[model samples]
Target: MSQPRATAIGFTAVLLWALLALFTVGSAPVPPLQLNAMCFALGGTLGLIWAVATGQLSALRKVPLPAFALGTIGLFGYHALYFAALRNAPPAQAGLIAYLWPLLIVLFSGLLPGESLRPGHLFGGLAGFAGAALIIVGGGTGFAPEHLTGYALALACALTWSGYSVLSRRFGTVPTVAVALFCVVTALFSSLLHLMLEETVAPQGLLGWAAVLGLGLGPVGLAFYTWDIGVKRGDIQMLGVASYAAPLFSTLILVLVGIAEPTLRLALATVLITGGAGLAARASLRRKPTVAVSASSDG
Candidate 1:
């Protein structure tokens, strides 16, 4: 597919993921590991069916084991931490903390074959970090000492996801195949974790089931599949910049759902993360000319 189309799909994934924070929170009362396992298993089943129908199941054999392993760890590890963080902290705070992956993605993308690190990226990363600090200090959420564990988990989520995305892009194969395998692996791991550490709590009402379905289909299922293609083929810099919108979008949804109240800290965090991404992307744009020139000379 064309880069433009891939970029659009990337943005679509971002929007869906924004809604994910809200839905994940709705699953509360449900154990994190159990919830993740069930949702991911369902999503994986859907993806597997699609892969078969689209004739991409054969591509699975071509996918290297390391790539599939990393994809599973990235997907499952990130969500595991994310769900735990949401359970312990306010949705906005957790979302803001986890959204740090966008800045990390910009930095990691520079390590790709045709990408380069620049001064703006450094400054932008710092700015984003500063924004995250402000969120924590300015009464965003997670003030108690007990909440520190969740905060740390959210931070780890950011790091794991950024590294996962970079590696995926650097070694991407067929999107559907990769995502399907990732879901399967994550589901198995999550289920195992649930058995070891958490108790199961089935969804109680129509609203609860709806939340599960939304997350499984939108974020866990289609979002990861499209993201695999996007990071491989789309403008990574653009997606990095676009990801800053997630926290803001998630916060709004939480507010609408009456799960969270908006705060001054969240507003400031929006400015910082968004502005930092723009600053980093400016560097990306400047570096593109060099990449184009290099490609041309090589050709």
Candidate 2:
């Protein structure tokens, strides 16, 4: 992909991520877990069929299956944390905290590629950290002991997501759709495991029911395709900048729905996150891919 289109695709993925947040919180009567499982099932099925029909199932075998597998499991955690956080924390707070994956990715990138931290990276990192701290202090939802697990899960979600992003860079030729397929496959297994070993809850109504499909088509499947193609084909770092938009969009959705009460703290968080991450990602954008891997390595 050209740099411009890749940039658009990345930002577009952020919109998809935001939509995932919106539907998850807005699905009032749906048991989020069940809905998640249903969505992944449908998405995986669709992707699997498409790949097989096109004789592209071989693409799955060519990518880094281990990294992809771990990433998919992380995606499962992300789904759970996001759904629970919406109920436990304010929508904006949840969005902000969850989106901290960018900083986590930045930090992790330092460890992986031995990239020296730049002035912009330092300031950006600080900004994102401060933004998160401010958001936490702004107090949309009180930090309760019950909310402890939710917060931990949310942080884990961010970290795991960062890990996935870094790991994805290891594979050079894996198609974006293949990545989506792997994630959905992993999610399907994780959901099934949850259903069997844990308590299962179902959506309460048609709106919630439709949310399952929407989640699959919009965020779970298509978003992955957009993101993989975007980041994979160009500067992954530049593509990452679009992620900051997710919280902004989520905040708007929350305000429109009357679930998120506006505050100056949120505004600061937005500026810090967008500005900081953007600065940091710009530094990363300077990086050129030094190694290439074949899809055959996936098997």
Candidate 3:
């Protein structure tokens, strides 16, 4: 796929993720790990079927073991740390810290080969972070020293995801189909954790079941495959900046569905996140990619 097309495809993941909060709310009664297990199981199963139908099943055999390990760990570890963080601290505070991945992705992309860190990228990243922070912390929740453990875990969650995303570039040769296996393994891990940690609570109704299906098909399933293409071949810096829109869009979705009330804060966040993304997009469009040492060539 062309770089532009791949980037567009990747942005769809962000759009899909906007529905995460809404779906999770609708999927009530089900615990987080159980929900994760069900969604990923559905996603992975559908992905495998798609692979078979498209004759991509054979291609999966060529993927390196390290890629599988990385993908599974990235997916599973992130949620584990996030759930732990929320348990140790306030949700608002812990979530704010965890949302640092987008900024981290932009910063970390500077170290990637053939990617230049522009002033616009840095400024845009900060702007986006500020906007996201405003939305997350707008409830007047303050961090307490008592929550240090949760805060640390939340930071680790950010590092795990950002590191996973940036390092994914090095494995550009890995087929996106491999994400199906990753999701499957992640589902197994989640199922084990759910069984060990919490009692099973099935979805409450049709709405809950539908929400789980939606999450599986969109956010948890196709999003990973498209994101693989974007991070590996598209403008990583731009996508990093653009990711800030997820939370903002999520809020808007909530408001549209009558789950959240609109506020001045939301309007301001709209400007900052969109403006930051636009600035980064302009810089990405103006600058040309240069020949540099490939990340895969490094030890």
Per residue, candidate 3 scores C-alpha lDDT tens digits across 97-203 of 99999889999999987888888888899899889998888877689999999999999999999999999989987777888888999999999999999999999
Model 3 lDDT, full chain set: 0.87
Candidate 2: worst-modelled 10 consecutive residues by lDDT: 290-299
**1-299, model 2: which lDDT tens digit per residue?**
45556657656777886777667754555555666666777667777776777777877776576766755666676676666676676555565567778667655655645344556776676676676667544555555666666666667668767777766766546666576566666577667766765676666588776766778777776676667655444445544444555666666677788878888878878888789767867776665544433232211
Q: lDDT of model 3 at residue 84? A: 94
lDDT of 1 by residue, 1-299 (tens): 66666667778888887897778767667877888887788888888888777777777777787887788789988988887887887666666678778778877887788777788877777676666566544554455676777778888989989888777775644454558778988999899989998877888788788888888888777788777766776767667766766656777688787887888878887888778778876776676553221110100
What's the ranking of the predictions by TM-score, best on top? 3, 1, 2
Model 3 segments more than 4 A misplaced: 291-299
TM-score of 3: 0.95
For model 1 the local lDDT of residue 246 reads: 65
Candidate 1 achieves a global lDDT of: 0.75
After superposing candidate 1 on the true structure, give the runs of residues whose Cα lies further than 4 Å from its correct spot. 81-99, 128-155, 289-299
Best-performing candidate as measured by lDDT: 3
CA lDDT of 86 in candidate 1?
79
lDDT of 3 at 132: 94
RMSD of 2: 4.4
In candidate 3, which residue pairs clash?
none
